[model samples]
Target: MSNTAQELKAEILRLTRDYSALVHRANRAGTENSVPFEPGKTTVPYAGRVFDQDEVEAAVGATLDFWLTLGPEGEAFERELAGFLGVKHSLLVNSGSSANLIAIAALTTHKLPANRRVQPGDEVITVAAGFPTTVAPILQVGAVPVFIDNDPATGNARVEQLEAAFSPGKTKAVMMAHALGNPFDLSSVLEFCRRHDLWLIEDNCDALGCTYSMPIARANALGIIENSPGIPANGTHVTRYTGTWGDISTQSFYPPHHLTMGEGGAVNLVSRPPLKTYAASFRDWGRDCWCASGKDDTCGKRFNWKLGELPRGYDHKYIYSHLGYNLKPLDPQAAIGRQQLKKLPAFIEARKRNWEVLREGLAEFADKFDFTLPTHATGWTPEGFTWDATGCRTECSWFGFMLRVKPGAGFTHTDLARHLESKKIGNRMFFGGNLLRQPVFVQLRKDRPSSFRVLGAMPGADEIMERALFLGTYPGLTTTMLEYELQVIRDFVRQA
Candidate 1:
């Protein structure tokens, strides 16, 4: 407001820009040489931040603006990303876990009929082999999570299990991942949702660009078919890209995920009416006002309306709508996301190409490893590489691969995993092996007889997951990195 304050702010802005420029220069200087992957020495990451100078520059540029919270960049990223996903609204959040929480929480709004909200103790069916965030939100909302055993070979939930999960008025929603880019029988899931009137949330965090045949929830609560497979939004039973299917789907922008907003994630919602779209408002700030971050009084009479028990002319901005959380991601994250979006098509293509290469290269060892490749039916595209095997095995990706050793294969998973780690070929145990068996599910298990049930016994779920590991095909991987990983497994298997 004062002359000195304005001048000081201008000077601070100048210094911030200068600092960012210096950091960019330093990062570029350090990246001049190619880094090679050395077995037993180099860390073959499952996934790592895949970025360049441009991404860093964009992020720092946002930082210099000092609009550190969700601002123009965040709004722009949400619009551009929603357009990319063929969805109506996209809300950027703090993380994938929060995205899941928001999406599920939005569905529980009183705006929908009381029965429609995922009531406490109501069952939300999901697989036991997925990332914890996928199912954590279920219990976090006080809804019972009915675990289903995944198809071990495909690492996807058995579509046939849905009918069982829904039997006798049990399920309120069905949520699951495409499972490492593999499309998980979306057709069946959607049809099941339609038949049961269950809400479907696709955890497309790992499978961003991927698509499967399904109807996109349109303006009328009507599922409209798409004419073109990859085109944005057109009207047939066309492919619903992974992030576009759910009534409210979500994606992670964490560095290791499909795209990096550093520490960001997003919730994608498709509402039948614009009024319903305001439902997400509560999630953002529980505000009665629907104006953009810095704007005011889009409703034209911000202080004229009488809402709740407040005075006759209350400030609309402070009116709380839905009980919500401050889970929004920062503008810098969105700035990075804008840069990442440009590289997404290339990233997805690289992942597909790398998967094919690994598939071909490991064909000879298929017998020994029992590697099962995902079968993408016509009109489907995958996002990542996921394969499991029965023995002293080796698989490849752009960055990491799996080393699943079956009991009958003359080696234990422990032995094979130890060998790979000792050789410096990085690996990770499959995400929360038998998630139901984990401690988080301890409370849920006690009432399993009355409140929940697994669609089937999950001994195979525990066995296969414990015996499997996930590596990366993320863009950060180099040829040398993949080659060394392949050789490590090849050498280990030869001994077996």
Candidate 2:
């Protein structure tokens, strides 16, 4: 409560208001005529960064504070995010990829009861259409990843195929993304996890606002309607919202993701024990202290306890619990995140509206081109839409689209990609489509073939991914821009 500190806080608040007003004015002034489409020159991205003056100003103000490391903004952002997601805990990390890595890595801890530990060579079932980080954690930890072929229709894994990916002897965990902003069949997956005692990790990077419900709706989604001692299961899944399920769910704060903390991610856990919660302690230099970033000595005796039989009185600050990394993000990034979070409601609504616009524009082509519009599971609301290009005839949210070429479709993915590229529309494959096809996975898979398996051979994965591309649906896009992009798509299809 120093005078200087109070003054600084006041100044920061001033800047936040100033920046927000500027953004508001800019939005009002820049109407339809302000932005024009530049054919053959402008880049219509699959996804891109979207920020207003609020984000820019928050980041700039944090720079003035000069804390540089995790500080007020980081702590506030973590708490705000946890509150928003309705989770008990949220730990910010350097990247969504790192968030996934740390989340999956946390499961491998021997500290957890043995049944929960993901043993080496044990299978972690997932899809091939997701970003590499989703599966990289499995390989990084020496575990086997059993790839499940995605349903071309939903751009999600086939729930009926869950049993096929599991072998009683090897499978220990199930990790999968919600496939762009669309939800996976969470009810069945949760049941499958319960039956097999598998660790469920939902990579919510792409599906941040999604909510899910159980089919039976008799009790809690994971069964045992209430939380129990030793093993807790009091998680309520009574149709609240989307982007809220998982034994341990993760979120991304990268620029292209739902929210931006520049380059950051968070690990969230709900109603877990102090012991399980403390498991994440290792991530922040593995310290025993639970104090927020700058404060210290909340535990009265800072150097009175002896751990690991070291000394009569060892420093608590120096105590290390688990092998971990310095994955924490800087406060400025978190400051930006806090500000960005304020706009999430609007951002989500814009994405949904844009998705509808794209859906309407491409409705006529639905039969001629194979397009799979994602359908939300009961009781879930998604942030965006994901369509499959299996028939090479699809219309997804224009912020970005996914296309999977069908067998004997009379066109190669490259041809379709080039066709779009020539017309000034942007395109990209589903992240590491058939990740096992990548060179990095060759050695990992070769060394542990039996421990690993690919769902349905996923030959279509390559076709869908290679042909798949998306356009930007970020908040920055306007209706005029989206319509112009749609025209480009229509023109390309007609010529083909």
Best lDDT among the predictions, by candidate number: 1
Candidate 1 lDDT tens digits, 1-496:
5898668766665665567555544222113244534556877666766666557667767776779888899999988888888787788888988888887877766667765677778888888887899988887777877888877665778777788778546578888876777667765676788877888888877778775544344312436454223455544235556666557788888877777887888888754444234445645676777777788998899989898898978999888767777787788889989988877877776666655555555555654664544533221123444323311111111222443565576666778778878877666766787887787676756755455567768865786676777666766556666777777777777778
Give one digit per residue, the lDDT tens place, for model 2 in 96-149: 888788777778766677767777887899987668898888877778888878
Provide the overall lDDT of each model, using Cα atoms, as 2-decimal numbers: 0.69, 0.68
Deviating ranges (above 4 Å) for candidate 1: 1-33, 167-170, 214-222, 227-237, 271-279, 375-403, 447-452
Q: Tell me the TM-score of each prediction against the true structure.
A: 0.84, 0.84
- Give the CA lDDT, 0 to 100, for residue 143 in model 1: 81
Q: Determine the backbone clash count of candidate 1.
A: 4
lDDT of 1 at 384: 43
CA displacement after TM-score superposition, residue 406 of candidate 1 (Å): 3.2
Worst 10 residues of 1 by lDDT: 390-399
Task: Spell out the clash pairs found in candidate 1.
Answer: 225-236, 286-321, 390-406, 400-472
